[model samples]
Target: MAASTQRRGRRIMMAPEELDTFLREARTCRVATVSADGTPHVGALWFVWDGTSLWLYSITRSKRWAQLRRDPRISVVVDDGEDYGELRGVELSGTVEFVGEAPRTGEPCPELDVPERLFPAKNFGLDDMPHDGRHAWMRLTPTAIASWDFRKLGGL
Candidate 1:
């Protein structure tokens, strides 16, 4: 992921360590994709952050998947907190690259090892990943990342 050179809200930005922790713990993210006709679609998905990249396991037949196949550009937001002052989130935007196979079925791809381990452990508390033939991997190493922790404002 490319570093954010955000100039407007430096005070509210999460430090690198804080961002990593947040992404690791967060459960669901909203993925935004554009169709060939320029229609925008957003859907919630389970993901894993491997310190450097975000991995999305998506159903190959889904709308989001179809749209991404047409156009790889995507934006993802992982956020938490109910109140204004408590809000914090990360926005990652870039193109996604399909990893492994379409509708992965436990292929021996060394590239998937880390995320395969991390995803189940974080989301399902499992020692190993269970592969459903419907889902496959997409990796987004963001071109730009912007994060904010409103909690850092100290109730202002």
Candidate 2:
């Protein structure tokens, strides 16, 4: 699908590359899902932006997982900055698919270690994460996305 864009003064819209960078640099994203009864569930998750899609490692037993099993649609938001002038973010909506096996609680598993490998290197400058197990990967291929950078408004 084509990238979504909204006009804001004279600044150019955030291109696809810019959106990838934004998702990569941000440490955490808020994932939103809906329950069978239509109640909204939102939670913070550590994610990896692998150029084409968002990969999330989650505990299989979590409520979010249960909700996603019933409904695969999800919305994710990743953003940063303390003040309004510095605010910037990306919002993505898509359907997610479960990938690979879920590491059972107290079991040893290596496939679900993207966080162990990528999170530390990208966020903490470390070689590896010091933990493991009880998690699974969820892949979201965004169908629609929107992003904004307050810095783009400086010229106005």
Candidate 3:
């Protein structure tokens, strides 16, 4: 059997349940922003989808935080590891807002000892790594949403 590579430009969808599932299953998303010189910047961030909205936290001193402070416009990507027909992901473009500091629930994890942050931290390493004193929280509001899943059911 020949494999077909189905393609579409904007497969954006906004169903409450589908969004929730995507958030639950995916761990990391690539965040894109613009620098002062109009160049594009991208970084991988751990994020959590809280039902109606997506919540992400960043430290105060990072360059991404500094750039985002000036420009709130951002693009986010969430996906899996599969190739070709088995690919799945969600791309989001939205307005960003800088909130207060990222808090720690209790004692920090041992991974916090590693300054490089090479280990997993989140429920499935799909979210941010909480450290001793990272910057703060940056929230993205979805002005537009696009999702793709080669699965047959398509989140039904």
Candidate 4:
């Protein structure tokens, strides 16, 4: 995971610990990918943050999957708060690496164990991951990150 290069709004920037907690508590992230035609596609996904990386479980047959196969570059944003003073968010950008089988059939991969355990427990309240054979994992060890919490501005 590369360090965040955020210079602007330093007062509002989230600390490393705060960023970790925010990502862990946030449920959805908007993923951005480049299409083969040079356009951009954005979609919402439920993701797990492992402190060092972000793991995305996506449908192998979806357009997002197809686009990623063609171009692995991606950017993801997880944000919260409706009010201006309460707003906070994190943005992670990097190329993603496909992990395990394309359509995961629960094949044993040690690299996936942590995320597999964390994802279900966080999202579904389950002890173990339920593999459907249609969804697979993509790991993004971000090259760049930017985060902010407006509350840190002291109500400014």
Greater-lDDT candidate between 1 and 3: 1
TM-score of each model, paired residue for residue: 0.97, 0.80, 0.69, 0.97
TM-score of 3: 0.69
Off by over 4 Å in 1: none
Q: Which pairs, if any, clash in model 3?
A: 12-146, 27-126, 46-127, 46-128, 58-136, 59-134, 59-135, 60-135
Each prediction's Cα lDDT score? 0.94, 0.77, 0.62, 0.94
Supply the TM-score for candidate 2: 0.80
lDDT of 3 by residue, 20-40 (tens): 687765668898989999999
Query: Model 4: what TM-score?
Result: 0.97
Query: Which lDDT value does model 1 have at 107?
Result: 84
Expressed as tens digits, the lDDT of each residue in 23-121 for candidate 4 is: 988899999999988999999999999999999999999999999999999999999998899999999999999999989999999999999999999
Q: Write candidate 2's Cα lDDT for 53-101 as tens digits.
A: 7888788889999999899999999988777767778888889988766
Candidate 4 stretches greater than 4 Å from native: none
Please state the error at residue 154 of candidate 4 in Å: 1.8
